[model samples]
Each structure stands twice: as structure tokens, then as C-alpha cells.
Target: MAVTSAETARPLALVTGASSGIGYELARLFAQDGYDLLIAADQPAIVEAKQSLEGLGVQVTALQLDLSKVEAVDELYAAAAGRPIDALAANAGHGLGHAFLDQDWNDIMHVVNTNITGTIRLLYKVGAEMRTRGRGKILLTGSIAGLMPGSFQAVYNGTKAFVDSFSFALRNELKDTDVSVTVLMPGPVDTEFFERADMLDTSVGQSKDKSDPADVAKTGYEAMKRGDGDVVAGLKNKLQAAMAAVTPQTALAEMHRGMAEPGSGKN
Candidate 1:
């Protein structure tokens, strides 16, 4: 992480998974709005991300670490060194594709840890402090994918299901407080997500049509600022989320399989 002054004169916003994709875009919004940044990601590419954010002229500190570990979250909080956080974008998450039975246990566990455990841990740590401060905003990057049962991408989607549900629960819990929790449930966006999840060969992955990460981030950022409980990133995704509420799980699972099944894109 780049060294900055112990305390930034500007507001501070911490964004995770910020090396690329929606996370990076969210960080840009913060920088543009004159907030100093603390960005973290599991990859070394975060160092480069910091360099780019520096061009935005606000103090930027980047931490490269695996947020899936509880200790890492603690370390991240420690790095903040008592600085007040004005906004938190808890967006670090991973996904796994293919049949659950065939997936490696380690991969499945990683998905659960990164998507669920790490997210809650960060939220709790930051949220507690924010509650005391009486002001803060939180944006959690959940997924429209969570609305349906992912047949081939079982573990990943299951974890997101937890996130989607947890977001609302947390929001309700914080309703009386000044701190706000908003969930961004986006469908597919053109990011490294499909490749990282090893779903590049799937139909959904191959589709040229997908939401732009910048647009999705903007939607979430705006919703968070307004203290809205949640925002689905696209009209199609909003419809999907609505449908999921009434659709039977068994049918949804089959529908997901048609898009995510191995080599489904090749057909």
C-alpha cells in the first residue's frame, strides 16, 4: 500500500476488489468526489490501480491481500489506523463454475469464504464504527444471479443468495441508525468475472450483450448516496429478480443450467 498522510483532510472511502471491474469504477467515483481512498484486492494489480487513482489527485492507499481470511480484514482495519470511514464498498467476492460435485472442495470453500464470511466480517467491523459515528454509507455488490438457483454454478450462486438476503436484513437492522446499507444486484457485466469463475465457455459468458461495469457502479453509487435499500443494475435484471420471487426453484435451476452448463456457449 502507498503511504499517505496519517489523516486525509478529505472524506475517506474504502473499496474492496478494486483492482478492476465495478470496484475500480466505484473507487473512481469516490476520487472524483474528492474522497481519499483505501482500496484492497487479492491481486498485485491493485498497486497499478493505486497509481491510476493517484492521477485523480486524491490520496490513495492500496492494500493487496486476500480478504477471504478474517485476519486480512483485521489487518485492513488496522491499516485504516483510526481514520473515520465515510463510505464502504464491500465488493470483494469470487465465483466457481461447473457442477458442484465435480468442483474442488478448496474452490467451493474459497467462494463461501470470500463471498460470505469476508463480506460480513468487513461490514460488521466498519458498520459498528459507523453506528457510533452516526453517519456512513455501505454498498454491497450482491447479484441478480443470487435470485435464481445456479445449477452448474452452485456454490458461487448459493453464497450470493446469502449476500442478497443478508443485505436486506442488515439494512433493516440499520434503518434507525444514520448508517445505510444498500445492495447492488447486477446481472452479467463485461468484467473479468466470467474468466475468473472459469465460465468463459458458458453461454452467458460468451454473450456480447452485457451491462457495462461503469454503469452498474454508477447505479449502485447513486443508490447508496440516497440511502436506498437496494438497486438492481438493469431493467432486465430487475425483471429477473422480480420473476425469481415467484418462480419455482426447480425450474430456475434448469434455466440456469441452460446458460451456465459447461460448453453451453459453444452450441
Candidate 2:
């Protein structure tokens, strides 16, 4: 697709995974804050999201592309050829809930590529630009799952761990620059994540106390705007993160098993 010039004078924010859930909320916040948007998701539903965001009186360009491929990340960046992105929310992720060995190799690779490979590629490209310009803010959606070993959701958790670690490293490296990189470690939120990960039968998925996607997004957006290094979304998640810091890995893994192991809810 050809890159288009920004149609408005507002700042531009590039948000991935913006078709729904937290990504959708982040895009809305940006619009509310007066930034025009470039939003992408693997599904065509992103077009509908674009329509809704346009209602907020900001120009929006929606792209439908799977971010699991390197080319797709390149295409997403190319699509913003003429605009200086004031913010980037790399919220795209994939999850597979089951025994790691039981998952398909293809599925595992997609999760890695989407969550780690593609995310880093886009960040490198956009981040380099931001560095040269001496300004920008980045929000990476990590997870509280990253703090533990997700028993049934192993690969998903591992990828988030990489994201969480990478965001902090990047933040430190860019500390002297005006660009800020912040990771948002949110606990379970009411989103399609559980359904798509095939975790609907698990205790965590079935729990009624999941965090609200809007609330999670608001927390991350506020932190990003403030240039904070990282923010864990909820009070419960904050406690979990604090505890995970002192807990042993074996115990954390076992604790995750109770909530995420297959058929955990049934048990």
C-alpha cells in the first residue's frame, strides 16, 4: 500500500492490534487527546474501528495485516512514510493456551513472531526515527503473565517476558534521548484474548473479576504520556508483580498452573 500524507494537523499515533479490546481503547484515548491515528490489526475489523475513531474528529487510517511477518511490519512503517509518529502503541500479541508440547509448531512460531519478532522490528524502525528526531513515546503491552511461567500458556507468557524485559532495556538505552519507552504489564482483561488463546475453559478465563480493558488502557496511556518507564495496570496486578519479584520460579510456575492449566476451571 502506498504511504499517505497526514490529512490533519494533529500529532500522529501508530497503534497496532487496534481492532478491539485494549488496543481499541488506546486508539480512542489518542483520538481524545487530539492525535490523528494509524491503526492496524490482522483482521478487517480494524476498518470498523477506524470508522468509530473518525467519529472523534481525527483522521484515521486503518490497515489490515498480520504482524507475524517481517514484511508486514515493514509495510506498516512504510504506510506512515510522510508522518512523524508522536506515539507508538505496540499492543499486538498472540496466545496459545495448552501444554506447550501439544501446540503446533506453526502456532508457536506465529506467537513468537507476532509478539517478539515483529514487535521489535517495528520498534527498531520507528524508534530509530524517533531518536533522530529527539522525541516520541512508546507503549508496549506486556502482561503480568510475563512475571510467571504460564504452565498451559507457556509460549504466550515467554513472549511477554521478552517484551517486558526488552521494553525496560530499550527505555534505559534511550534515557538520554527525548523518546520514552514504557511497558504496560496488565493482568487479565475482558477481551478476546482468552477466547483466541483457547483458554475459555481455564479458571483465569472463567473468572468474573478480570480487569477492564478500558481501565488498563487508561493506565498505560497515562504512563506513556508522562514518559514513565513502566506501569502495571491494576492494584491486584501490582501486588502480583511485587510478589513475583520475591517468589521462586518454581512456585510462580505452579501458581500459574492453577489458573491456566487446561480444564483448570473444571477441576
Candidate 3:
């Protein structure tokens, strides 16, 4: 496909964690919508994905960035290089599960760095730029797990709670501006996320019946376009989130056991 004039003339979307999962799918959808793209991920697959996107006739720039480094957040903005970022999709993150205090502190901090601090910094930078330009959309990948306490996945859940909560508050803050913030809350996505998190031995990791990343990304894209504050990706997740609201934290934690510990129980 030739680059559409509509695409060639406008600022493009910048998608983080774009090598795979919902990020990759969102990048494809954004390209389809005639947006040129800047896709970044620490994984090598990001390079491959960039080449593939270029074949679709949209201009694309790729970067290998590890958000956990903290400095990478500013470096990403530097890579933007004064281009108006029409859209920002901050979808790069990982999960950390197990008894909270039993886990390595380094692992815990890395998770916090990637999911919380790095994300907030990126949001602050790009969002401020968007506000000055008076227009932009932001999609934050949160998790339905954030709705309640998570036992084995305690720290990961805490991070999502922050993201999901922060997204809504930020949306309200940006309401007067041309910027809109949307949070994509998905559960049990069929991404390589679990394996990458070293959670391949768990039940959530082993589940074959996970939601497709493409579908989840579509939901996010639609929600971001609509300027919705938060969207739970699947119906089952919506129900789960709803239930978590009324259910006690203790009960919710117990219910979350199976999904968190895939290889945990007796057959």
C-alpha cells in the first residue's frame, strides 16, 4: 500500500512494547488508520516488526528500549525528536508473582520501575507535549487484576491499581485539553508475557484459552478513540472487575489463586 496522503501529512502514533502482544496489534491498527509510527521495545522482535510495518507502506521508526532502566523513558522522548506525537500507547510491562516478601527485592524494584515510575515519566513528558499542542490520545495498558488484592501476584496487582487509578485521574485532568487518556484493562491475554515474566510454570501461564492480543488491542484502540476513561477488554473481565468491587479483598484473593498459580494444585 502506498503511504496515504492523510498519513504522510500528520504526526504519527508512538507505541511502546510494540514487538508483540497488544502493543504489536495496536501498532498494526494504528498503521491501518493511516498513522505513521514510532514503535519501541527492548526485544529484538521490535526490529522485525518495524520492517513488517514498513512493508505496509506506512513510515515507521523502531527502537530497542528497556523501560526498566528509567533513563530509557527520557531517551524515548528524545527519539521522538520534536515530532508531534498524535497518540501515545504505553503498553510495555511485565508481571511478578509469588509470595511478596519471599521474592527478590531486585525483581520487585525492576517491576516497579517498568510499570509504575517509567510509565508515569513517559506519560508526563508526552502528555505535557500533547497538552501544549492541544491534541493527542493516550492508552495505558492496565489490568483487571488491579480491581482487588492479589496474593501471589501482590506487587504486580499494586502496580496496575496505580495505573488504572492514575489513568482516570489523568483523564479528568486532561478533559479541558485536547488530550484524552484511556486505560486498557485486560485479563489473561495470550501474550508471551507470562514466559517473559518467568511465570511459565504457573497456571495463568499454561492456560491455552487466553484472550487474543489482537482483540484486546482493538478494544483499546476503540476506547482511546472514543476518549473513554477506562475499558475492561473482555466481558468475563468486565464481570470480574465488577465483582471485585463488591467482593471482599480476602475473597477476591482466594479466587485469584488458580489464575496466578498455574502449576500449583493437585490434579
Ranking by TM-score: 2, 1, 3
Please give, for residues 173-225, the per-residue lDDT of candidate 1 as tens digits. Answer: 88899999999999999999999999999999899989999999999999999
Whole-model lDDT values for every prediction: 0.92, 0.94, 0.87
- Residue pairs clashing in model 1 are none
Which tens-of-lDDT digit does each residue in 1-267 have in candidate 3?
222234247568989999999999999999988889888888999989999888888888888888988788878777766678899999988788777877899999988989999899999999998999999999999999789887778889999999999999999988899899999999989988887666777777777778999999999999999988889998988888889999988888887776675466332
Q: Where in model 1 is the C-alpha error above 4 Å? A: 1-7
Ordered list by lDDT, greatest first: 2, 1, 3
Question: Candidate 1 at 104: error in angstroms?
Answer: 0.5
What candidate 3 gets wrong by more than 4 Å, as runs, is 1-8
233: Cα error in model 2, Å: 0.6
What TM-score does each of the candidates earn?
0.97, 0.98, 0.94
Clashing pairs in 3: 202-262, 203-261, 203-262
Q: Provide the lDDT at 238 for model 2.
A: 97
- How well is each residue in 1-267 modelled by candidate 2, as lDDT tens digits? 443673657899999999999999999999999998889999789989999999999888899999999999999998887689989999999889999999999999999999999999999999999999999999999998898888999999999999999999999999999999999999999999999999999999999999999999999999999999899999999999999999999999999999998899898
What's model 1's overall lDDT?
A: 0.92
